[model samples]
Target: MNLRLMAALGAALMAGPALAAGGAEILKSQCVSCHAVEKPANTSFERLWERKGPDLYYAGSKFNKAWLEKWLQNPERIRPAGELYSRHVKGSDKEDVVDESTMTPHVKLSKADAEAVAAELMKLAAPEGMVEKGAFKGEKVSMSMGAMFFNKLRGCAACHSAKAGTGGASGPELYTAGERLQSDYIYSYIKNPQKIDPHVWMPTLNLAEPDLQRLTGYILQLSASEGK
Candidate 1:
């Protein structure tokens, strides 16, 4: 090989580990206070409720890398109500409302840091067989049918919103799920949320295979049309 080519190859090889190490260091310093990089031993309801942010132990399995990278640079609220729904909720005799003032915004990172952090986060994978491969077959569902299933049949809209400023706020907004999460993770989580996080408030719906596929497709479609 030419000397110039050999030098370039050497730099590329060295950059990978260096970047990962920097990412790990950034995560430890900046993110570990709120997010769990490793799975926690204590998963009690009280412990889970006290969490400041969603667990990142399975980020690689859960999030799309490109979305994660971009989102880190310009962090936006994915969970409208807050990480712990109970904390932000204020109850009156008539109804309970989320105290938007209490919601904390995520700290944004620089472009270089975002790239490094996303790369490191993508290394935190779920255990073997946790996310089924090829679970979502890129199925397409009509907006009307998908809306019926998400809003009326499954009542998912009670917790998650299919559109911005619409539906419930207790759960993370589904309007961004397509761009934010991995397809297989979305399908797997919908199938059984507790299987992934035993203390999560989301119930096990025990949906049939077809229903699972359709719902996942609906969420993906809804997310795709969010900004447009």
Candidate 2:
């Protein structure tokens, strides 16, 4: 190899770790205030309720690397009512309403920082067996069939919306789940949310294996149809 080419290769090899370190430093300084990069030892309801943002300890298992990179650069609200539903809700005579002002937007990172951060985040994997292997087989579900399972059968629409400006505000929006979440994580979490987050508000539906597969496919299909 030419000396110049060899030198370039050497630089590229060194840059990877340096970029990861930079991302870690950025998270430490900026994101630590709101997000928990490390899993909390305490799983109390108070600890869970006081959380400012979603736990990112298993971000690698939860989020798509491409989506994370782009989202970090231009942050948007994934949860319409905010991370802690109780905090953002106000009771009315008829029903409770989410106070939009209570929802805080995520901080945006520069393009370079976003890339570095995303690279680092993708290293934070879940504990072994947290995600079931080959759980989702890239199965395709029609939007109508998916909706039937989500809305009527499973009652998922009570908390999650298949589309924007629809469904309950307590849970994170499902409209972008296809791109935002890993398919295995979705299936596993839906199979048993308590296994993932001990204090998570989501209930265990005790869904059948086929139902799990269908729900997973539906979420992916929903996001695609919405152009997310």
Candidate 3:
């Protein structure tokens, strides 16, 4: 073989390991500085305040894979102010320093890398079935009724909105929750938020089954409409 061809093969061989490293390895090297792959033992506000990013222990259950893949490439700020901890703190002695604090944009991942990372993340699921009987899948709340519940009855609009760039910025945008999240996951998380994420700012509504079904149905419809 020609020397030129041999050099090219040698370079390709050298680059193989990095390109072949799996998503978990990529996450360990690139993402662990800011994110956690395991559930935190301490769920206190103070403990959460020390975290640089949201935990990824249950990313598989919490986010849609397509959304996660797209988000990794075209990153957007989910929490406008920052994580719950950064947004609530009042003084300069705050411990958590998030991307929002530095005004740094999220690192954009290549499409292939994003897909791999999302696939790895989706492997992490809740140990048990957290949703109760998967109630919201068949609930029949009308759009108007759902709107009433979201906007007035349940007061969900106080922190969450039906569309992007329209609702309160503190919480995540729910305009696409139906497409972005699993229905049962929503039911489970809202039913007992602490069970999934301890010390989260979201309160345990302890809603009755009917209300839970109605609210979940409303969110499903709202997300389906894309806030139209």
Q: Which candidate comes out best when scored by lDDT?
A: 1
Worst 10 residues of 2 by lDDT: 219-228
lDDT of 1 by residue, 94-194 (tens): 87988878887798999899998999999999988778878999878888998899999999999998888899888999988999989999999999897
Write candidate 2's Cα lDDT for 101-203 as tens digits: 7877778899999998999899999878878867898878877888998999999999987789889888989989999999999999999998888778899
In terms of TM-score, the best-performing candidate is 2
Model 3 scores what on Cα lDDT? 0.75
Residue 11 shift from truth in candidate 1, angstroms: 20
On TM-score, the stronger of 1 and 2 is 2
Count backbone clashes in candidate 2: 0
In candidate 2 the C-alpha lDDT for residue 1 amounts to: 97
State which candidate, 1 or 2, has the greater lDDT: 1
What's the TM-score of every candidate structure? 0.88, 0.88, 0.83
> Which pairs of residues collide in candidate 1?
none
| Clash pairs for candidate 2 | none
Stretch of 10 with least lDDT, candidate 3? 95-104
Ranking by TM-score: 2, 1, 3
lDDT for each residue of candidate 3 in 1-228, tens digit (9 for 90 to 100): 999999999999988886777688779988888887876666686867677788888778778898889889998776665675345434446632334445557778999999989899999886566444455666678888878877888877877867776656556777777767788788887788877777787889878987888888777777767833
Prediction 2 global C-alpha lDDT = 0.88
